[model samples]
Target chain A: MLRPPYEIVLKPYGKALVELARERTDIICLSGDLTRQTETDLFRDALPDRFINVGMAEANMIGIAGGLARAGHTVFVNTFGVFCTRRCYDQVAMAIAYPNLDVKIVGFMPGLSSPGGPSHQAIDDVALMRALPNMTVVDLADAVEISQAVRAVVERRGPVYLRLKRGEIPVVSEASRRFSLHEAQVAKKGREACIVASGMMVPAALVAADVLDANGVSTCVINSPVIKPLDAATIVAAARGARAVVTAENHSVIGGLGSAVAEALAEAGVGVPLRRIGVADVFAESGSREYLFDRYNLGVQNIVDAAWITIAPTKPVPAAPAMPLTAGTYAPV
Target chain B: MQKRARLNGKSPGGCGDGRLRAGAPAPVRVGDLARLATRIRLHAVHMVGIQGFGYLGQALSAAEIFAALYGGGLMRPGWDRFCLSPAHYAVVHYAAAAEVGLLHPEALKSYGRDGTELEAISTERTPLLDLTCGSLAQVISGAIGFALASRYAKDDRRVFALLSDGEMEEGQTWEAAMFAAHHALDRLAVVIDANNSQVDGQVNSVTTLEPLADKWRAFGWRALEVDGHDADALVASMQSTASERKPLVVIGRTQILGGLKSVPATADGHFLKLDPALKAAVIAELEARLA
Candidate 1:
């Protein structure tokens, strides 16, 4: 269900983890000194014994997480998206990924959500993680998925990299909706164009689908939270009927959701015209999310333009309106 | 760069707790450790000879250290965890492990062959080690993790990591050093094969770490420097952790070739290249030492 004026859910990830830790004695948490920003502060304060502050050394933290997992504990390592992935990629690869340890790498402030510019953006994290063998990569959509994914990812056997957005997360799905790692949620159904979106771009995708439907272009939107082992069946089935496909993500189009979708479609032999909506292989500047999104062509209008242009290549598509970023609301049109 | 007298100034007998576990036997005698070291040298020479070439210099230099730990009972079988931080030291580790019956002696012949568990450089798939050192200076942190886990589980089993002198140049080594000391991982011990040799050249010629023991002590650890080939001193310095609450690092100083006379000066010991004649001569010398 596509909900308007999405309500804010605070610390959903932290609360869910603390609740889960109450029952799972083998659950351990590690932070590279971004406990509050990455939403592991609640775990630190509640389960002090199980929480470890590795003090900004991402490499050492990852190595310690591997060791802890070797000793029969599920470790949740938290830090900013960039610091956790790019800064210590070798350690993560050799220590955690190679051994296929049970470590959940929680990276916060996915993509341009951070006002900290290129240095803080994890634009290539998905690509790096996806290339490693036995790594499960995911980008959660909203508060519901973030909370549900905490338990879902722990049940998994090997290493997992879960990308998240920090601070007041939006409630995009119904409160009763169940989250599953194996299924990609179909938010809206139509036949003219298919929109595949992940992470922060899911809301923009939803608004674009509604506007496209109002303009008499039937659009179907699928929210794909798990990026690596993608739900290809539902996406290929939807693309099979649609005349065009537009993939959206809050990451670089080179190796993120767009690339994943492109591979899936190509493998399935669904030759529908495709347009990828993402950061066009460039480092973004520090700014508010609204400014960065529009500048990087991640706004609702970009998806609409991509969706419109691909469906009717012979006709010049009219420029769509900018997304209305209202106060106290998430992705309002 | 130049050799200095032992820094701690504690005699081998004065150092070490020397507490034997109840119903636990004493360590292997010094003469037996010597024989075990001789067997290790013979096996390493044979294995490297079969592979055409390998890190035979490293195996020769650290043969006694490996013998003391694996065969002399310094490292308890199935109790303590051992981390091989220098991946190239797999030559010595495999020979030592095989000498102790952990691995079949015949497996040494497959060294450096395709699809064999004994890779020239150790990896995660390498058997008998708690954690393998794929890249230099990274495995110590994993050893610290194992030590931390032992503490959390209230298990007294200690953790040991073997490093090389070249690893001192890596910043991650210092990062791990600070972390282990800050946490006061007393149950963790590291034995560095300060053999003064690396691929680029000698360690000091590349990057001087002359005040090595001081650097470790400054980082909140008890540092000990001793003759690496003396198994008695190595075991004594290693077992001095019963009362200490800080981590211990034994800097076992060694030679590049452990004074092997057959190889000419032109032969670089870093990655030793042995022709058939030189290989046969080395094997005969090591075999005579074993006999």
Candidate 2:
């Protein structure tokens, strides 16, 4: 599912939400004045009556979302990942999460995907959301997952923090493959090493698996969309037999996919050599996704090298060349 | 101003779900509401005195506002929603709810106990408060949501949010004020208990928020200033919402422990520590007022 000539879907999340709202009258969409940028403009245009532009007040927007949810409407709060999570975390925790309201906080531009630097990048959103009780944290890997996830979260009760990448989203998976909130999809299976990754890093992890396979290191890749309520069984099973386990994410290695997988492995008693590929604990600078990912050591080669290090400790793994990216080209599985 | 005048002429009909207790007298006039306010204070004294220390000042200051809201029947139990923005004021809310029959009087005994619904600072588990996050200045935003949702459902039920003067210090309160006015949520009303009291001393000393009504007016709301201790004024001001297109903000000027004179002026109203002697004096003072 992860290869070049990758089909790009424009505003799949916004369109999917609009379609969902057409049938579900209980759905209400609120935006913190980033409607067009967050793709909530589609929902605003389609369902003008149900759409509320709450200006730039993120805290009030979250509170209003909570109130709407309390009034028996499932609310979709849309804004940048940074604004929705870190900016209004208290409101999200108190107003929405504490009561376990049915408010879907849609945070666009996850991790280093935003060139808007530290203020705009939501590098620690998963950690923040995961810390809150009754908060379902989801980081969709592709357009297919995003489209399916919008409906999947609404079906389940309680609050959800869904992180999405804005603009042209890559469709890594088929429409037939359903998105599950409780499960992880094993994209590739191998015997020697396993690469557990989520969101933007999933594609890179897939490409890294291919590179490892070619280098005579058979690697398995697991695509985890749900960061919280992690499919630990699938991860632990894959790690149980593998010689090396590598977890990758588009977030800091501190409290996201890497930490979650590490916790799962430790609790499950699956003692395997593991490597994490992500942003080292530091505030990121403004740059393109490609520049930031590579600069932060989150490229495909980084994942391949990390996987190799787990298996061969003392020897320095051979430096692999960076993968070339073209228009509509996302690293594939 | 004319709308305010017109509302003052006729007493609000207790048309909402009868909020008074089963045996309690129905509040029919200004005097009835005033007496109800005193009863609310007495109930609060009982609850807070049981805990030795609690947010007694909030109850004392917001007594009349709650009486007009709950006892005077401004809020319907199942129909309308009430948001207690200041979580610490849960003591006052629980007392008022007990005073009205929304909660049993015996249930007030469990106030602030571990594993009890009546938390010292209200959480989601707290009874009676429709939306409370155990944080100050945040619940008003949720009240705006309720008002917006009610508008969508075509339900004419109103939402009343009780806020502390200190909450104005928070930026989110003004954000919610701006949103409510922009949307013209007429059914939503906010009662600011400008009790001039907070944990860090007087609200004015900490954050100089003078000309509070003007601030709300600037933010596009129909601002009404009234003696917060005057239950008639609160009921009248809240009832005047029928003609208003914009959201209403009733700035009720009040004093901590205003209705009671037993506590010294220098005493902190935020959290009152009732020694056995002070507790007896407070109860005696409130009991005489109730009589």
Candidate 3:
């Protein structure tokens, strides 16, 4: 099997972002002292006036971006996924997402991109962002995809959370393929089963599909780059045609790509046996990135096993729908 | 039951008979500003009364400051351009915005009603509000970001943020203050409604932010102190912008329970009961003084 190319890395995306910023003066970038890690240093060096370093102030960084968005500047804030998601949830919700501000939140080193441990891992970022009403969540599979996603978000106006891995992963999409914020891409076509994946897991799912094919299990791999809005039609079609579905992600299985696919299938009234392979609801201990992936059962083998189990489905059970809340009973405020 | 006369379109310092025109100019005056402040308080009381209870202590205490800012024309309203940080004193903002004709006066009546947008905390979802600020220290930094954008764009417009004294205790507030000072956001003006009260008690007793002016100055801000209730002092402090460096922080001292005899001036200002009689008495006293 031929290995995917890794020549294009994360830095080029930051460079492309800076190049785009030069053309669009409304673009502003902010970093929480992680420019080097996020590769936004390229943009910072190119456009010094447009880049701001809040220096370990993640909360302030989010707030500042919100304010900048209000003043008609399309602000892009970059930081580690953990800090951007968990540390500054309030700022993101109240200042940016609630207003539906045109602030792009770029979360670098997402989902075990860093080997530092669970502290740096962004397992629940999707869940956190999905809870907000007006937030668009995206997970970039490779460096090439990051540039396209960033450009798409800049051109489109709204609050977006882009999860980016630090280093270069295998490029799943070709240069000719254009990406939209809410559309899903089918990486490979097969009839037996479909594997819906996002972010770093897309490459793994592709590899797993190849493995399953050699074992006489024809598999389809769908790269769901846009996690929010769930690309319902593509997902429903994939689920309907395939005998079963395997959803994979580097994020937590609770509210990441797997959960999003599951919700979409349920909402579309398409009943198919689905299996999720991702981080369980627990903080990971200190380990190397490879070791953590193996320990969490998120590797290609895990995807193959989950896919096999889902395809051998038996019977369906129907449950009663939950009653709607009465006026006095519902209190979100 | 004696019906109170409406004072719409009437000049400042007018009689209740609606006949005697005080002959004041259509232009906003300092005394007229004070009257506007009194009217804001009246509306605030009425809104809270409809809700049965609310954060009226904080709202009433900050009315004069809101009046001074709006009446002075320092803040640009009626145009959907400026942003307001309505953290704890959102009722005062709603009342003042309605009085200034920025929002419909009928909207004021919808305070705390079911499905109404006028929430207890200011929300960014509302078109009139630029950012939601219920979580205390969040809005300060949001304002600083706005100020930075203004500076970047060279727009020359100022971003005004009204922060609570208790909100200063939030670490994010200090973070924003330090950033503002470091950035030298001259276009940003922060007004600390230093009512000396919080949900618990007095700010000093609850969490001491002693030498508050020194703290802000140390954080690289040009800090000033003023009587929060005194419109002239608040207006003067707000008008005087430092040309040298640092963002401006006008720490306006206010009474916890201003103009309310029933509610004692204490730190537990979150929940205060003012029955119909007490409300009537306060409004009558205010009416007589203004009359």
Candidate 4:
């Protein structure tokens, strides 16, 4: 079993952001009635003028943030991942992304963070945001990492889409641990295989690495907090050194962390057997977080199994590239 | 000039072109405004010719109105920054900006070129523009924000936004209209190019904004309708607008595909193919009008 850091957990990320907001008066928080769920209510209670409740209008909320950003305010717009991605995609691309405004979109309840059903689950946010040219996509592994990522986004003046998981997530870093945006962090080191994971899957990969160590298979666990701008050098070195790679994420296997890793390997001309363990292309049904995790094969056992398969001598054939998408063709209104 | 055209025995079109004489001296010369409008049209035609396709039809239709605003001194020409909502009139906007000395004429020629800062839609990179506009109805809300900020700073700088009739289909436009109205954004003036046509067909066939004036009134805006091509009428209405407690919307009715017969009015004006002869004719007509 792997141990989680206790100093700074996931829930405090929102609280820490509020504390930071006190010093930076320009930071305004807007929520689509998900303040309690995303832990942004902690900030809202403290700064009423700086906090705006846009009701349930995710699309309008994003527009308002973009407007505020244009007026030189560092605005943070928060909502569930599903609504933030699919519901208000046009606002993200046109208002926030295209304009390159200083708006940080915090998508809470990413992947199966909620047991509310398919509607609440956000499995394709990374894929959706990464498609845009100028957008910075981030998936924080734990609460401590979340705070660091939030501060980094504030300092970096551009549009950022942050995918955050809800409720109590295991801590993946210390409060004092500093990391740069768009850089990958090494959680565990080994030579036999490398386990690359993002967001919620980082903790699972750590557990799987411990399990692999007991089984006499050494593994290196890398936490990729930033999804877009993939941190090519770090990922490439990890791929070049390891015999095989296992990628994990709490998102769709199609366009999340796994797909990003594969693209990096192919671009660098480094050939290694890779296994992607994530939710397949299907909507998650209503169930507890544990049920969904087990159902989608996103647990420690699955990661270990995938890692073992990747390192096996008999390598599987490489998958073909998916069909190309033309501009303005993805999702139509 | 006070020709009373009434509906239901009441002056429905309320105070026609006669209101111009009563206004405190007009901001711009009528002939000069007309010349500026012709130049805007000529520039739009050439810009579209360079692209091989563009929203020339709507651009030409909106030229006179844009000219009136830019040339009349009602809006600070080189100093006032604009937030354009309906993005199809890129060529017209750039040309007007150049004529007013806000941007260099050379920069206008560089539009749509590889790595050019002048994009089809208004972007903040232009410096003269405050917000990027392409997706419909977004600029209205953005303008509201800018207007509110100006109010906070106690600045008299106004936010001028130009919207399209077709964009009225977007619900956010109405939301912004209501928001601006409730806040009494008198320093903000929105000009709607109501050419009566949009992509697909006539706006009535797609989404009708009949009683458009009533809609603005319901949203608590002081609405005024004007002949879009008549620069003098537009200048008068703009000058007489209340500047303290209420928002204003100038619904300048225009002829769709104006000055060009081949350009289909019913089609979406974003992309259009112009024949060489028609292009020359447009250029000649604009030059002659300006001369």
List, residue by residue over A89-182, the lDDT tens digit for candidate 3: 9888887787677888988877765788878889899899988987899988565677677789887667889888776544556777778887
lDDT of 1 by residue, A275-298 (tens): 999889999999998789878888
Give lDDT for model 2: 0.83
Give the winner by lDDT: 2 or 3.
Answer: 2
Best by DockQ: 2
Which parts of model 2 are misplaced by more than 4 Å?
Answer: A313-322, B1-31, B242-244
A1-333: candidate 4 lDDT, tens digit per residue: 134322234476688789889998778898888889878888888888778776676766777777666656788888898888888788788877876778888888878767988898888889999998678899874766776677888888778898887776555565576767867887788888888988888767877787777766788988898988788788888778677899999999999889999999998998988899888888888887767887888777788778776665465422212223333221000
> Candidate 4 lDDT (Cα, whole model)?
0.74
Question: Worst ten-residue run, lDDT, model 2 chain A?
Answer: A324-333
* TM-score, one value per model: 0.94, 0.94, 0.88, 0.83
The TM-score between candidate 4 and the true structure equals 0.83
With candidate 1 superimposed using the best TM-score fit, by how many Å does residue B235's alpha carbon deviate from the native?
0.5
Which has the higher TM-score value, candidate number 2 or candidate number 4?
2
**What is the overall TM-score of model 3 with all chains considered together?**
0.88
Candidate 4 chain B: worst-modelled 10 consecutive residues by lDDT: B1-10
Ordering by DockQ = 2, 3, 1, 4
Model 2 residue A152 CA deviation (Å) reads: 0.7
True contacts kept of each: 0.39, 0.60, 0.49, 0.22
lDDT of 4 at B170: 86
